[model samples]
Target: MRLKVFEFDISNSVLINTQTQTQHHLTRTEAQVLEQLANHPNQVMSKGQLSCAGSQQAVMSESAVAKAIFTLRKYFGEPYIDLIETLPKKGYRLNISTPPPEWQQQLAQRKKLIILASCMMLIAAITLITAMHQYIWFKTAESPVRESRVVTLNNHQQIELIWLQSPKKSSQQVSNMEQKIITAFNLCPIVKWRDVYLAFSNDMQVLNISMQGYSSNGELLVRNIKTSDFSLQPNFISPNWLQEVSLCD
Candidate 1:
């Protein structure tokens, strides 16, 4: 039977067969060592050079190279030096035409499939982990509710008010006030508030107030008062009417 060897692309592995079309695959390291042997056919390759070329790191100990050669021999079996002939202290050479047993070819194919499956699973796991991390970051990154308030300057004068709620602290009273203000007026008006003031109470309550001008030349003023403020009203819609009413015109 005519023996043939084929080299694989991008890896140090090879396929060898005798007459039959049956194929076998080898790891890159195994293939590189085999190719070196095929070149000399009957000349031994230096253990040092074989280790360096066959390894991913471009260098390996002599003992490591020898172990790899031994494994290859055990797998391929006779006529193949069994294809490698060891020259003790000298190196190794291929006897060529070394064909593996029919049963072994099937076993090798199964091993390759297992390796491929393992790699695919690892990639999937990494992708899933990354997605989970991003989702958690998005969930914890920002506040869900916005805060706003309105202030009446006089019996005939009233203005719309709005502000961003502080994420640092909160209270049910402040929460109710925020809802009332939002319900009473359109928040985030197109016009800019003229003067802005920020205030805070010992209870961690915060207040933001601003004054804006309406197209009618009328003035619009607003305040965002936290319910936590002790000075807040029972309605809590406007906390400490006087203290929270800083002008923002």
Candidate 2:
């Protein structure tokens, strides 16, 4: 009995037509390997040369390259080695025809999609970080401002009272006021007198006072004044109706 044989074109691209008559496509790397094999036909190309040809910096291991070759053979169904032969310790040569036009187009499309998706993800991450930073800045800008005051007595016995005005007015205005006060008195290191008394005037409503004194060693002594229980009389002097109580000895 004579066997029936079917003739099919193998040149174009690597394709696996199963016994069930189903066609499967190859990836670009696989196709490139097959193309290399087609070019070498009978000679074995080294793994290094093949990797370089594929624009890869590092050459794949021999076993890995062999596996790729095996996959290519399986994809073509029949032994593609008739056109391309794999030489041990050597590279593969082209023994098969070119891949089908449709396969090449599909591979190109897949690569393009991969590149586009990666770019989009990077852009999205950058935009999210920028928005978060802006939100943080706005929150800090909207928070209530903190107030501080300083008073200094010069060697000439002149009194200088310094206080932080509301920053909402103008930064330049506040800065200028502070500079003017500092220049007028030429006050030495402002010291918080411990024996000073604090009191609120009958006309005032709300007052918050914070005092920090530095020791000879540059250590800070901090005091938070809440209500008007302390006095600001002969020991400590300030122009403001509210005053900070001196807690130091």
Candidate 3:
């Protein structure tokens, strides 16, 4: 079974972060501990139980188990690390219950709030930039509407990646776009990409993505290269824009 702890997307032994669109390779011992804790969820699994979760022939010391857990926590960062709760003499558990009563409901609504916030921020920033420039003109492009993929060459350049949903689009088209996005992320700093944040409209058809770039004083540049098929209405599921999404407050 696969599991996600916060930003980390676990598919068998491989861990990927949907936000950064980057892969997180875990050590064998870390994988074992993560799987064991993820499998059990809210229930505490003793160090012995986690150590034996993988190869029965391979023995793991209690200290080794502790180290694995420590490393796993550090890798995933905050909030997520909080999910791994330690028990005195017992072991550890994934504490998804660490929240108010309606945490999942809050998660569902978070997408909309983020989209709204991003739009506002972008608009405000652009207005300020326009005031600074003597003149500005935007160009229109005519090309096959491909799903959004953002890559930046400098720290001062920000890019937007939008995934659209349309009746004319086949499921495969959406899949291909996502695969391309993932490939771009895999290319990393070499591809000129830095960071990522995920957001979606209230209807869930549109995705609002933010890619990190350069700061104004640091080398300002404004380029909104949108590649979206206007014929299609964006659907959150089709492009599976954030299909492998995992949340951490």
lDDT of each: 0.54, 0.48, 0.59
Candidate 2 segments exceeding 4 Å error? 1-103, 119-205, 215-219, 226-249
Candidate 3: lDDT of 157? 42
Candidate 3 minimal-lDDT segment of 10 residues? 240-249
Predicted candidate 3 versus true structure: per-residue lDDT over 43-145, tens digit per residue: 9888888878756653788899999888877766774667688998998887754344687778768988999999999999899888965555555544433
Q: Rank the candidates by lDDT, best first.
A: 3, 1, 2
> Higher TM-score: candidate 1 or 2?
1
Question: For residues 69-94, what per-residue lDDT tens digits would candidate 2 score against the true structure?
Answer: 77766655564344446666656665
Each prediction's number of clashing residue pairs: 14, 25, 9
So what's the TM-score on candidate 3? 0.35
Candidate 1 overall lDDT versus native = 0.54
Total clashes in model 1, counting residue pairs 3 or more apart in sequence or in different chains: 14
Model 3, position 26: C-alpha lDDT score: 81
